[model samples]
Target chain A: MPTVHVQLFKGRTADQKRAAAAAITEAVVATLGGNAATVDVIFHDIERHDWATGGKLWSDQPPAPPTPAAP
Target chain B: MPTVHVQLFKGRTADQKRAAAAAITEAVVATLGGNAATVDVIFHDIERHDWATGGKLWSDQPPAPPTPAAP
Candidate 1:
């Protein structure tokens, strides 16, 4: 049995997840030659603050503030 | 370099996650002999409703209601 774990940002709907799971299962079965029914695709939603790249958290990215009107 | 992806329920504090990451990194380095810095332990916090087992969603489990005594 192949267990596929997906790590992604939170906020996806159930339909989206279901579709993704189906696609992943199909692909794994096709590539690895196992029954699709046996494959498990689990999704893990990561909060932006908890995920970091190159020692910097995603949530720390600077936001673009609105430009001030000329006086 | 080894990347460990942990799938678990939501509600872990930052301190808990930090401890887990450190432990995991150390273990990976000891077992695989790779630089600890290169080892990544990413956490994916999942809601109970999003996770399932044996075709049943975990959130669907009936909660134990308050016990009522005979009047």
Candidate 2:
């Protein structure tokens, strides 16, 4: 069983998660040779205050530019 | 930098997360020769419906017995 943990800034919709879960499962099965049913993709939505880089929390730093919408 | 992802059933208190983060950081530093500050321990609070084992979703299975309190 292949378990994947994806960490990203919070606020993604359920639809995003659903699509991601399916895409991830497909990748894992294609590359790692595992059953799609057995692959687990868990998403961790981390708050900006909780994540730090170079000793400064993301909440304290300048906000990152928004991600471009998918085609 | 070493990053750790911990997946467990949801509903744990903030104090529990604080304790777990400290303990896991210590373990990683001691065993893997990493700086404690650089070790990221991200906890994923998984819902029962999102997790499965043996082809059964945890939410669909019988309730698990409560964990005994630590001394």
Candidate 3:
């Protein structure tokens, strides 16, 4: 059994998780030769205050700019 | 940078997390020769229903017996 652990910022919708789990399972099965039913995608939601980079907490830093919409 | 991700059953207290993080950071630094300040220990609290082993969900199984107290 192949288990994938994904760390993500909190606030992702259930729909997002569902889509991600399906896509990840497909990719893992295709690339790693595992059964789709045996694949597990576990998500860990982290808050900004709990995550840090370069000695600075994400909560203390300026928010990232929003992604631009494609034309 | 070395990042340690720990997945555990939910309901852990903040004090437990603090102790775990400190101990894990110390171990990683001692074993791997990394700065304690640069090490990251992330805890992921997972629900029983979300985790499965041997084709069975943890929530569907009987609760684990409590650990024995020290003599």
> Which candidate tops DockQ?
2
List model 2's recovered fraction of native interface contacts, to 2 decimals.
0.14
Q: Which model, 1 or 2, shows the larger lDDT?
A: 2
Per-residue lDDT of B1-71 in model 2, one digit per residue for the tens?
89998889898999999999999999999999968899999997897655544334466669989879777
Q: Tell me, per candidate, how large a share of the native contacts it keeps.
A: 0.02, 0.14, 0.02
In candidate 2, position A35 carries an lDDT of 81
Cα RMSD over interface residues, candidate 3: 4.2
Worst 10 residues of 3 chain B by lDDT: B13-22
Candidate 1 regions exceeding 4 Å error are A1-71, B62-71
Docking class of 1: incorrect
Model 2 C-alpha lDDT per residue in residues A1-71, reported as the tens digit of each score:
98777788887766666667777778778898968788776767789999999999999999878879788
Best by lDDT: 2
Task: DockQ each candidate and list the results.
Answer: 0.11, 0.15, 0.11
| Candidate 3 colliding pairs | none
lDDT of 2 at A65: 89
> Candidate 2 at residue A4, lDDT?
79
Q: What would the per-residue lDDT of candidate 3 be over residues A1-71, giving only the tens digit for each residue?
A: 89998988898899989989998999999999968999989997897555544334456569999977444
